[model samples]
Each structure stands twice: as structure tokens, then as C-alpha cells.
Target chain A: MKKVTAHDVARLAEVSQSAVSRAFTPGASVAPDTRERIEKAARKLGYRPNAIARSLITRRSRIIGLVMSYLENQFYPVVIERLCQALQRDGYHVLLFISQTEDADEVLTDILQYQVDGIVMASTTLSSALASDCQNAGIPVVLFNRVAQLGAMGAYSTSSVTSQNREGGRMVGELLLRTGHRRIAWLAGAEKTSTSRDREAGLCDALAAAGLALHARGVGNYDFAEARRAVHLLFRDPASRPDALFAANDHMAIAALETLRTELGLRVPHDVSVVGFDNVPQAAWPSFDLTTVQQNIDEMVDATRNLLFDQLGGQVMARSIDVPCVLMERGTVARRDDEPGRKPGRARQPA
Target chain B: MKKVTAHDVARLAEVSQSAVSRAFTPGASVAPDTRERIEKAARKLGYRPNAIARSLITRRSRIIGLVMSYLENQFYPVVIERLCQALQRDGYHVLLFISQTEDADEVLTDILQYQVDGIVMASTTLSSALASDCQNAGIPVVLFNRVAQLGAMGAYSTSSVTSQNREGGRMVGELLLRTGHRRIAWLAGAEKTSTSRDREAGLCDALAAAGLALHARGVGNYDFAEARRAVHLLFRDPASRPDALFAANDHMAIAALETLRTELGLRVPHDVSVVGFDNVPQAAWPSFDLTTVQQNIDEMVDATRNLLFDQLGGQVMARSIDVPCVLMERGTVARRDDEPGRKPGRARQPA
Candidate 1:
């Protein structure tokens, strides 16, 4: 089979080769009827404009380097699908780089080599050196669901889109309080992540406001097995066990729920209330019926898209946008006042 | 910061520009000592090779177009992460395209326009016309976890990698039968998907061998909400309720489990048993602890990577490789003989 060329389409469409090229080039000027004719001819001859060759002249690959980790988290899969679809609609393709480690440094070299027009780091951190390198190289970078530390970025900062983590955490804490859940426990994700830090801080703020402190804390590092281990450790001493457990994310919360129910044979809400951030799809399942903080995925993804395009379209300053989150009230949160036999301050039975 | 060029690197390393290019190209030969000096200079200058320009010269983009649909399913997230990591290790990058619809037709135009060296269709189907178009364009396409219809592809066939879905389904059927499940219902995914059709067929084959048939069937279209709807439909009438249910995949099975336990207030394995294919990570969660068929993901991925590379390395024949699947016995299945109060053929109480 002969390879279809621009010349063949040009000849068939009765247009110049340059005109055919212009017709295929996005945002290039060509008469509407002539462009239609060229497109018809190209389709008939099965001719596709070579994007690689075009990138050489335009210096735009139209590829966004998406650095992500922890696909196990249900939130990310939902975000990834929506983000990809949104970007694709804007005629941009995603060059996916799965960062095995927490930081994006390892994959930075490969990402830069691709000459992508922009980058979106989701659930992955970036170092000061790499952050500056991206800026110096004139590539736009956006951190999704995260924010860069002021000290980490130094003079060069990357654009970021994040939910109001601290505020969301406070909401969760307050909800637990309003439902008469004292002796609250906090479950943390990876220690280094700003998300975990902010959420914990928010919960602390809420506790401080009410003149109450965390009963206990456990670290899961945002992993399922680790979360299960943390749940065990948190519940080891039944006498001191928390009446309410708040995990940084739904993944950990789900794991905690499983351990509490299956392993310990403890009843949710009745015995202990549970809350989590990131209202992942699993949280809504009838089996779990988890109450969590809903990070507006649509609003977050849209903010990310805007941040990236703002830079790509020649906007100068790197900005950070935080979309507000909401609380999802579900069966998991039990109002202590409604329980006929149990008092708010009474000691609960051990699992 | 000024942009670093190959010439600058060559000058700094005391080598020719062509030599600098060879040092960066993946299989291009360069003296070890010279390459080391060139790399050192490139590092000093922060010069990364332009993959876009190289693609133009080599006519090999070193990019695989990964067309996937249904990221909601926990199984695909696992596959995507592993696939990306493996391909990156092999010096290939994945250009991700999310197919919004069931078919890959819409994304195919953008995929071809990118001139990716190869394509991997994961949970997406291709039409015959597009199959031949890819073949004529001299591009290799591989369907991961799926196979193509002979009639659809005409003379142009694409390679595929899949687990033994039929055998897996049969195994599930046999397991349920061994547990004394008399009325076994089958829940299906999308009706058009080969995965769903093949699994249903295999289930029927096992029932035929046992001198029985599917007591009832419902289609979920491999969606969570749809699976919930199907579960309600299957169990709506308690008199005709199946003693055992086999969902085509773990996602649907999880949904069915949630519905059965929470909505229908039925005891899993005591009143009815549930089984699913594709032992996703969620299925192993203590809350689900699903009894399902485990498609060896690592083996399947390895087969896909090998098949793709073989074709890219000049192998002509389109191969179909089916990795064997095994049954994972967790907590969901129950032995009917163990229940002293009930018989295998007794009617279940209505929800």
C-alpha cells in the first residue's frame, strides 16, 4: 500500500501543498471551503498530518506530561479519567509517567526529554531543583491536588490546583463534634504530603476550638495494608479506643472500616463513628455508607486545566487555586443524642 | 536561561554534533568513554535530547497509544499503572487516550494523527475499517484483555492478549455447583463486549455439563450503577431468587454484594452465594473478600508487552495469547451442606 501524502491530498483537492498543510494545522488560516475540500480529500486518501514533523516547526508537541502515583486510591482514577477527557477536548494528549516513588524527580528526566508543552503532577511531589528546571526550560507545570511549599520552590514556583484541605478537615472534625463524637482519633496518610499535614492541622484546629484534643493518632501512609495495620494499632487498647476515627483519605477510611467491622466485630456509628476526606466512589457504596469530605473533582479538574492553560497562553505569574470541599452526610455518622440507651459521655463497650 | 543545544553540548564535550546525537539515541553506537564525557557535559549544561526532533529523523515515535475506557473499574487502574511502568522501563512512553464511548472510533483519529509507533487497546473495541487502516499504515495494534472478531477485521488482523475468560467462568460455575447451589444466576457486563459474551458462554457450558442452566440473567454493562440496577432486577422476586449469583467481573460483584447485604438484607453465603471474575484488589479487601477468578495480571501484561514488541521488531503474524486464570477462594462462598436448617433447593425469603 502506498503511503498517503499531503501532496496527494493537495492534488485531489485542487489546492497548493502549503494550503493543505495550513488546513491541517490547528489555528492556521485557510478559506473555510478550501479547508473542507482538503479535509475531504485527506479523509478519502487516508492522510493524517504527521504530528511529530509538525512539532519541529511549531515547537509545540501538544502533549501534557502527567506525573501521578498511587493508582490504588479510588479518587485518582476518577480524576484521571475526567482530566484526560477534558484535556483531549482541547486537542491535547497526555504523556503518562507513573512516578513509582513519592517525588517526581526520577521521572523528571524522561518527562523533559519528551519536550511536552506542559506538565500536571497529580499526587506526586516535586523538588526545588526540578521545579526550577521546568521553569527555566519554559515549560508550564501544574501540581494537581497539591501545593508547593514556599521554601521548596525558592524563586520558581509551579502553578497548583488543590481542594481546601485544611478547611475540609475542619468540616469533618466539626461534623463529628456536632454528632456528639468525642474521643476523636486522627488517621494520617504519608507524613511528607501537604494534604495529610493540612487535614491533620484542620482537625487539630477544630479540636482546639472545642477545647478538646485528639484521643489517639495512627499513620497509614495512604496504603491499604498500612491502613489496616494502623487501624489495629489504633484499636489495640479497647479502653482508650477512639469513639470517632477520621482518616485523611477515603482509601484509608475504607480500610479502617473493614478492620473495625470484620476483624474487631465493632459496629459503625452505633459503637464508633468514622469520617474521611475525598468522597471516593467506594465511600458511597451501600455496604460502607461512609461519611466523608467531597473534593469537587469537576471543579478541581477545571481549575487545573485553567491553571495549565493560563500559563501556556502566556500568563506570567504562577498561581495557586484551592477549590472548596463539602461534607457528605451518610449513615456512618451517628448522632449520640438519638441513642436511647447510650449517653454522649458514657464509656463505650470494647470490640 | 538560554536553551541548551546539541552543538553546545558537542563543543563542551569536545565531540561533533552528530556524536552528541548518537550518545542520546537509544540503540545508537558511541564510544563508552566519549559517551560518558558527552553525558557529563550535557548534565552540566542541563541539555536533554529533544525526543520530538528525534522522532522525525528516526520515524519511530517510541510512543504507544493506549486507548482505554472504563477507568472506574479497579482492575484497569492496576493494569494502567503496571503497563506504564513496564513500558517506561523498556524505553517506550504511553500516549494515553480515554475513549468516552464503548468503541475506540472517536479516539482513533487523534491516535493516528499523533503517529504513535504502536497502539494498545485496553477495554476498547476497534472496527474493521480502522483495523485495516492501521495495518495499511504499517502500525501495529494490540488489544489488551480482549480479542477481535474474525469477521470484523476482514484480512487485517491485530494481535491480542487476554486471560482464559471462558475457562474462568466455567471454574466459577463449577465452584458454585460443588457448594450445592442449585439455582445459579449470571450477571453480565456490556452485552456487546466479547469478554462478557465469552464468560457467559463458558458459564452456560459448565451448567450444561451439570445438566442445568442459568436460572436468570441481568446485564450491568460493566458499570457500578448499572450493576446495582441489575442486582435489584435479579433479586427483586424472592420466590425466583437464585441461590447463587455469578457476576462477570469483580466490579459488578462488589456492587451485587453491597446491594444484597445492605438493600436486600440477605446473608451472603448463608442465604445465597456470590462469585465474580477478575479478582481485583478490592475483591480481596476483608469487607468484600470475594470468591472470584483471578486473571494473572502480571502474566497477561507480560504477554501484551511481548506481543507488542515482537510486532514492532518486525514479526508479521498477529497472535492471540490467553493466559490461564485461577480461582481465588476467599470468604464469600458457603458450603450448603454446612447449613443444618436449609436444603439446597429451598426457596429463599423475599427482601
Candidate 2:
């Protein structure tokens, strides 16, 4: 026979579930007759409210606390949304904790009273001690986007899709060389992330193959304003301005285009060709028409969803998945033969 | 003196709060010395444990189950994001339970275990029985977006802010009548949502004021393909063809524009005028410089955030807030002198 839960007992007794809960709860009040009838119905139905019954035997809350930060980022939203949906699909109701300003200790304290099943930290820079605290209570934590110092615990690590960062950088380097560009400028995302480090290594590999090195480089912290500032620095010494600009991501590329168009009043491709990764919706806008590398969001999302399920279901999983990237050429670059503009010496000179 | 919380002990012990929980919990093990030291400190500090103690004395999970849905919509991500953040900030980690196109009873089983403190129905159409199930358990559910067939106990409702449809329709009606449009048509979203209803009603009011009625009308769901099909139906019989078209929302407007431009070879405002609402970023693109009503998303987000906080912090709040809208006139609407290129007798036919 299937488990006859409290809900079934409530139905059989014609009393509310809370009435049954009160009947089972010591010192909790229920009308005398209703309590007798509930007790009678419970015996007849073989109702096993063991999870609640266990509350008296072992005071476990069974609620899992989840902390997700950075909802504004398109990537985080979709990921968190999926995580929430999947967790809900499982038996666990997530108690959500969000930190707006990296308030780690406060976030940890906020959920302490509720006593959750476990905590899943999404987009956090939480210290190792916090993770220790959650697990120290015999609660396992799974970190998403952020890493934990302890490797034994579960963590859904996100790496770039496609040929790892080193290979991706090499592809860009080879493409630049084939197009006969010698001097290049590179704009990188925040130096803190492992992603930036790997991609940088790959780019160096490609540039080294062509017997050339990056002429100008700057870190943009993976944001538009920072990219704009970095680009401005590149232009300060016009003598070494790169022929082509390779930004870490599309947002930075769009910023470069905006600065070039409105500020410097330069026509794209003719003045400075730009390339970016992650072809966000705006990259295809009639204005920018940027060349980009696609990072298979569908595959990435699928992998994440599946991994989360595997983890939830107690299935062991490998540490990471490297999705591949493919170059998408739009209107951003120009061919050498077509480059006859104002300055003769300035013609197709790699920065 | 204020009661000392778990955080204070966790800080003093240099252990996580869950450690404090595990220490106090019988059969919930911690190192014996660690448990003794914590017990000593807590007693010395005159700190009483919180809800879990009461919950242990009684038999309650102290968890609030949440039933959430909706993912495809962009705003949903942000909504859930903030909801999760706020709920977490309020000391509740959402036990994410999601069921996609499956029997809800199957999902409810997961929630049955640690009978929750309350239930918050963020998204989904919960029938009366389900609502009662929650209410009877003394679970207060605050519904978001979806209405309660059973008079809802607590609800945060939305009022249409994107253009008072009737006013906007009337504005278009007056402009069309003044510019001499004898035939005007309506393209509408699904009849289910209140948004569609208000806009349609508003349109009818405007057209009636000008002594004009819709020459033809078609219905479509809020999707590009569906709207495209609805617009196609409007052109099936050319005899009742409209001189102008008003789409319920911007996506539908863009669909109509694309069809009119690519398939019908019609010039905007000259051959047919078009208007829409919710000026999404795509509407501002040079290719589709559509006239639209702007829904103040920022203000709406602010209001929603505050409302959620009010509810979380034991404060009652207003049922709903209507943000407001603005009509942006662009290249799509025609003027008096501009009608020279249109049909001769059709000049200035009201609405």
C-alpha cells in the first residue's frame, strides 16, 4: 500500500490538516471530538506523518537554505531561475537568501534560525568559514559560479563552453595573423575570475605562434564603463593605437563601438575593427553589427540543469564541462583590399 | 537585555550558526567538548534558543512552502530574483518546488513532509481546493499575478500602466479621424489577461467618440508568430481593409509592421498607420522606429520591491499600484498635409 499521508487522514476525518497536526502535536489544541475522530481516522488510514513525527524524535527542520546574488545579470537570472525550478521539482522547498552587496555573514545569519536542509550559494564571494559553518551543521553546500575551498563537497563549477580559454585565445590569434594584423590591442574582463586567466593564456599562445605579441592591453573588469575607460587609455598614445581591438566580451565591444562612434567620430572597420565574445542581443543591433564568438548558451544551460539534477538525485558528477565556441563574423571587420581611405600610411596598419 | 541570538554564539565559538543548532539538537552530534563549551557560553550569556526550540516543543517545520512558475518571460527572472532576495532577507529560503505541466498533486507530496509555516503562491493558477488546503493548514499564501477564485487572503495585484487603452485608442481615433481614415482595424492579445481587456475597452471608447467602429479585428496570443497569423487574417478580405492598425502590444505591432513592409509593400502612415504599447528596445531600432506607449518598468519594479518588504516585515499594504504610461509619436502616424500621397477621397475620414 502507498503511504497514507496526513493529507489523506485530513480527508478521511473531514478535518483540516492543521487539526490533524494539532491532534498529533502534544499540548496543541483540537476540539475533543475532532481529536478523537482524527485519532480514529489516523489508525484506520495507517497515516505515516514520519517526517513531522521525526520532528519530535529528531528536531530537523528539513528546509534547505539557498543564497543567490546578482539577479540583474541575464546569465545569473536564467541560471537561478532554473535552479529554483529544479530544486522545487525535487522534494526541497528552497528558502531563498539574496545578498545585494556581498553581505556574506549577514546572509548566513539570516537563515540560521529557519535551519535549512542545505544551502546552495549562487554568485557569492563567501569566505571558506561560512561554507564550513553551513556544512559544520551537517549541511552540505553546492556553490554555483563561485568556488569553495573544500573540493570534497559538491560545487557546480561553470567554465566557458568550447575548446577551453587557451584554445579560444589561440583561435583569435590565428585569425588576426591570417588577416595580416600584427599589432593588436586586447581588452580583458576582471582579472579575478579564472575565466579571464585561461582566455588570456590562449590569446598569448596564438599571438606567440605568429611571432608577435599584444601591442596594447587593459583590464575592463567585465563591465562597459571600465571598457570605455580602458579604451580611452589605449587612445592616449595614438602612436601605438591597435589596428584591431579584442575585448573579453560583447558588452565591452559595444562600449568600444559607442566610444569610437560618438566620441572619436570614427567609422567602424575603416578606423578600428572590433571583436567580442558572447553575441548578446545588442551585438546584432543595426548600429554595432559586431563580430563575435558564440558560447552555446543552450548547451550550457542544459549541462547546468542536468548537473543540478544529478547532484540533487545523489548521482556523482565530474567537476566541469568546457563548451566550445564558434566565430560569428558580422559587419565589424574589413578586408585589406577594400581599405583605401584618407591616410595612406594609416592603411591597414596593425596597431 | 536583548535576547542573545545564535549568531552571537556562532561568532564567539568561531563556528557557524548551524553548529549552534547541531549542538543544542539531541542526537544531533558535535564534538562533545564543542557542544559543552557552546552550552556553557549560551547559559553564561543567558541566551535562549529560538523557534526551533518552540518548534521542537510543538511539532512544526516552521517552513513556508512556495508554489512558483513562469520562466519564459524576461520580467519573471527579475521578479523571482527579487522575490528570492527579499524572502531570503526576511529569513526564509525558498524551498523551490516547480512542476511543469504535471499534476500538482505529485508536487504537493514533496511539500507534505515538513508541513511548512505558510505558502506563497508566486505564479500559477491554484484552484479553490488547493487554496483551501494551504489556508486550512494555517499557511498564508500571497498570490502574485494570478487571481484567487476563492477570495484571496493576501494578494499583490497589478494595474495596467502602459497607456489607458481606451484613451490611447481615442487618441489614435482622433488622429485617424482628423487625418481622414475611414477604415481602422484592431489586433489584440489573448482575452485571458486583464491587460488585453483594458486596452481593448480603451480602444473601443476612443473609436466610439469619433463615431467610428473597427472595420475588422483579429486576436492573437502575445507572441510574434501568433500575431503574424492574426494580421494575415485581417488581410484575407481586402474589401474591409483598414487604413490604420492598432496592436495591443509592441511585439504584435512589429509583427504587423514586418508583414506590411515585406509582404504587403505598404508605407507606414501613408498607406497604413500603426501604433503599439510597451516600447521595448526593439521598437526603437532604426528599422522599426515604431510609435508606442511606454510601461514604466523601473517604477513598477520599485513598487513591487517595497510591497514585498511591507508584507515580509509585518506591515499591510495597498492591493495594487498603477505606474503610468507615455505615448511616443514617431514616424508611423500621419498628419493632415501628409495625406496627399494617400487615396484621394479617403482624406481625413475620422477613425
Candidate 3:
């Protein structure tokens, strides 16, 4: 098959090659009638302006490198979809990289080869060295849903957007306490993640304020299998089993709910109550109906885009924005006024 | 900040500019010690070879355009992660486009401008005209998890890798029948999707072979809320309620299970049996122990990668490959020999 070129479209439309190029170029000055004729001819010939050539001349690729991990968690996929849609609306394409390993230096190096205009590290941490490398290369980096521990010295033009995980945890703690729960156990996600640590800290702080201590603790590593195992170990001793459980994230919380009900043959809210963080889509289902903290994904995505665009437009300031989370009261927790033998209240409709 | 160029690296490293270029170029002849020296100086000076300039010279971007939709469905995230890993292993990057609308023509046009080497349309249909345009442009396109109804004339240069939806549906039918289920209902995905239609057709074919017909039908639109509504409608009349339910995908199947057990107050496998396609990770959870048909995602991904690479290597033939699905027997279906009051068998260990 013969390759369609600008010259072919120009000849067919009876216009110069430059005119055909101008018609394809966005924001380029072109007479409306001539542009229409050129577009018609281009359509007939299936001609497309080579972006590689145009990028070389403009020195901009209009592409962003999105580095993410943990697609299995469900929440990450929602965030990724929203981020991609937001970026596309702004005329930027995403070059996606799924990091399978903890050290993203190698993946970051490979992404640099593509000359992406900026980097969005969604749910993944960026090392200070790499942050500095990006700073020196004039590439902006925005950390989404994760924060860098790089102190002021290493804060090299890296911005971050995160949910108020600690505050969300505190809300969950207060809800569980107000519902008349005493034996409250906590399930943690990956211990290394800032999200897990901050949430755990907030829950602890809230419990301490209420003159109550966490009855038990286990690590789920943000995985279903690990969470199931954690549930079994936490509930092994019948005499001391928890009256309520709070998980660091929804995936683990769902796993705990299933394990407690199916394997342990325990009734939710009557025998034990459960609360989780990150009110994912599954939390609203009839089976789980888990009360959780809702992370405002849209706001986080908007902040991330604004930060990247601001950096691209020559505003180089590193800042962190924390969006508040809302507590979604659902079916898992027992109502304070309910009799001991009565059924739990129906799940509240999402507001 | 000033941009660092090859000349700067050469001057800093005390090497020829050609030697510096060769050091950065893969497979180019450069002494190992001299290469190390050049790399060190380049790192210090922040000098990296620009991909846009190199692509202009070589006429290859080593990038693949991955067009996808429906990330909300859990199955798709697994597939995306696997496909991205496979492509990255072969030294290619993914430029991801999430199609928010039915017509992908605009997205495809934008992707083409980036000069991607090929495209993998995962679970998205390509218009024949766009397929022809890609062919004329010498860009290979592979339809992953979907089949093209493009008549022989429109086949142009498109290949596809898909699961045997019909055979899988037949397997579901046989399993339900063998388990003594008489009245089986099916909840389908979006009507226009090939995955939905093919699975439904195969299911009907199997039931017809058994001298029976599908007892009930509902459209879930491949969504949880829709599936929950479908479940309620199907069970509204207890006298004629379905004895078995089959959902075209796992997400809807899960919704049906939750609705039946929690809202409808029906026991699974005793009052009704359930089966779903796509053995997503959640199927193995103890609470949902769902019986499903497992699409061999790894093999499908491998086939998709090979197909795309072959097309990029100048192979012009368009072929359709149907990978088989396996029936994963779990806790959702009753054993044929069990007494009417006995509990369903425990879920089988994943092989």
C-alpha cells in the first residue's frame, strides 16, 4: 500500500503542502474554506500529520509518564481511569508504566527515554535521587496518593496530592467507639506505605484520646490472601476475639468480612462490627455494605493535574495538598439504640 | 537552567562527540571503559539522548498504543497489567488511551499522530474504515478480547485474540444441567459487545442441544447496579423464580449472589445455583466462592503480544485465534448426589 503524505493531500486539494500542514496543526491560522477542502482531501487520502516530526520541531511530546502499582487493589484502577480521562481532556496522552518492583529507578530511567512532559507517580513513592534527577532535567514530577519523606533538603521540585488518611482513620475510630465497641482490632496494609502508617497513627491517636487501646493488630500487606490469614489469627482465641475490626483499606476489610462470616460463622454487627478505609464500589454492595471513609478521587486528580500544569508553565514550587475524606455510614456498624438481639440497621444511602 | 547536549558530555568526559553518541546508542561500538566515563560525565551534566530526535532519524518510536475501556470491571485491570508487563519485557512502551465514548475514531486519529509502531485494542471494536486507514498507513492493529465482524472485504490487516465464549457458555450450561438445575436464567453484558453476544449464543446453543431453552434473561450492561436490579426482577415472582443463574461476567455474578443471599433471602446451590464467566481474583473469596469459567489470561496475553509483534515484523495476514476456557468448580453449585438438605461442597483449590 502506498503511504499517504501531506504532498498527496496538497495535490488533491489544489493547495500548497504548507497549507495542508497548517490545516492539520491546531491553533494554526488557516482560511475556513481552504481548511475544509484540505481536510476533505486528507480524509479521502487517509493522511495524518506525523506527530514524531512535529514533536521534533516543537520540542514537546505532550505526553505524561504515569507510574503505578497494585492494580489488584481496585481503588487504584478507579484513580487511574479518572487521571487518564483528566489528562486526555487537557490534550496530554499517558505513557503508562506498571511498576512490579519496589525500586522504580529502573522504570523511571526507561520513561525518561520517551521524553514525557511530566511524571505522575500514582500510589507509588519517588526517591529523592530520582526527584533530583527529574528536577535537573527540567521534568516535573507529581506524587498522587503518596507522599515523599524527602525532608526539606531533598525536596527538589516534587509536588504531592494525598487524601487525609490520618483524619479518615480517626473518623473510623470515633464511629466504632460511638457505636459502643470495646474490643477493636486493627488490620494494617503494607507496613512501608505512608498511607498505612498515617492511618494507623491516626486510629491510635483517636483510641488513646478515648482511653481505649487497640485490642489487636495484624498486617495484610494490602492483599486478600494475607488479610484472610490475618482474620483467622485474630479470631483464633474465642475468649478474646475482637468485638469490632478496622482495616487499613477496603480490599483487606472485604477479605476480613468474608472470612469472619464464612469460616468463623460469625454474624456481622451482632457478633462483631467492621469498618474500612477507602469506600470502593464493592463496599456499597448488599453483601459487604461496609462503612468506610470515602477518598475524594476527583479532587485529588484535579489537584495533581493543576500541579503538573503549573510546573510545566514554569512555576517550580514543591507543595503537598491533603484532601479531606468523608465517613460513609453503612450497614456494618450497629446502631447505638438497637437492642442486643435486634438486627443491624439497613445500610444508609450514599449522600 | 541550560540544556546539556552531547557536546557538553564529550567535553566533560574528554572524549569525541561521536564516541559520546555511540556510548548512549544501544548496540553501538564503544570501549567499555570509555562508555563508563561518558555515562558518568553525562549523569553529572544531566545529558541524555533525546528519543524524539532519535525517532525522527530511525522512523520508529518503539511505542504501542493500548486503547481500552471499562476499567471498572475487575477482569480488565488484570489483563491490562499483564499486557503492559509483556510489552515492557520486549522493550516497548505503552501509550494508553481510555475510550470514554463509543466512537474510537477520534482516539485512533490522535494515537496515529504519535506515530506508535502498532495498536492493541483491548476489548474495543475498531471501525472497518479506521482499520483500513491503519492498514494504508502501514500501522498494525490487533483487536484483543474482541472479534471483528468486518466482512471479508473489510478484513484489511486486523488480527484478534479472544476466548471461546460460546464453548465456555456451553460448559456452563452442561455444568448447571448436570448439577440438576432445570430453570436457568442468564444475565448478559452490554448487548452490542461481541463478548456478551457470543457467550449468549453459545449458551442458547447448548440448551437447545439438551432439549431446553433459557428460562429467563436480563441485561446487566456489565455493571453491578444493573445486575442487582436484574436479580430482583428475575426473582420477583417466587413461584417461577430461576433455579440457576448465569452471569456473562464475574462482576455481575457477584452482584447477583449478594442480592440473592442478602436481599432476596435465598440460599445458593440449594434454592438456586450461580455461575459466572471470567474467574477474576474475587471469585476465590470464601464469601463468594463463585463457580466460573476461567479465561486463560496469560496465554491470551502472550498470543496478543506475538500477534502484534508479527504484524509489526511485516506479516500481513489477518487471523482470529480462540483460546479455550476452563470450568472452575467451586462452592456455588450443588453436587448431583447430595441430599436436598445437605450443604454445598467446599470450593476446590485453585490448580
Best by lDDT: 1
| Least accurate 10 contiguous residues by lDDT in model 3 chain A | A342-351
Every candidate's DockQ is 0.72, 0.26, 0.64
TM-scores, chain B, all models: 0.93, 0.62, 0.90
lDDT of 2 by residue, B236-341 (tens): 6766667788887776888788777766777786677888876765566445678877765566545545554454344343244455567777877776445554
- The lowest-lDDT stretch of 10 consecutive residues in candidate 2 chain B is B154-163
Per residue, candidate 3 scores C-alpha lDDT tens digits across A1-351 of 565789999999999999999998889999999999999999887787888888778767899999988799889889889999999999999999999864477799888877888999977876788888888777889888888877568556468998999999888888887877767799999888889999988887777777777888999988889999999999999977787899999999999899999989998977888989888988987778999989999999999999899988895778898999999999998854454533232211223
Q: Which candidate has the highest TM-score of all?
A: 1
Residue A330 miss distance in model 3 (angstroms): 0.9
lDDT by residue (B144-164, candidate 1, tens digit) is 988886754268777899999
RMSD to the native, candidate 3? 5.7
Chain A TM-scores, one per candidate? 0.92, 0.67, 0.90
Worst 10 residues of 1 chain B by lDDT: B342-351
Candidate 1's C-alpha runs over 4 A off are A11-15, A26-37, A337-351, B12-14, B26-37, B337-351
Ranking by lDDT: 1, 3, 2
Model 3 chain B: ten consecutive residues of lowest lDDT = B342-351
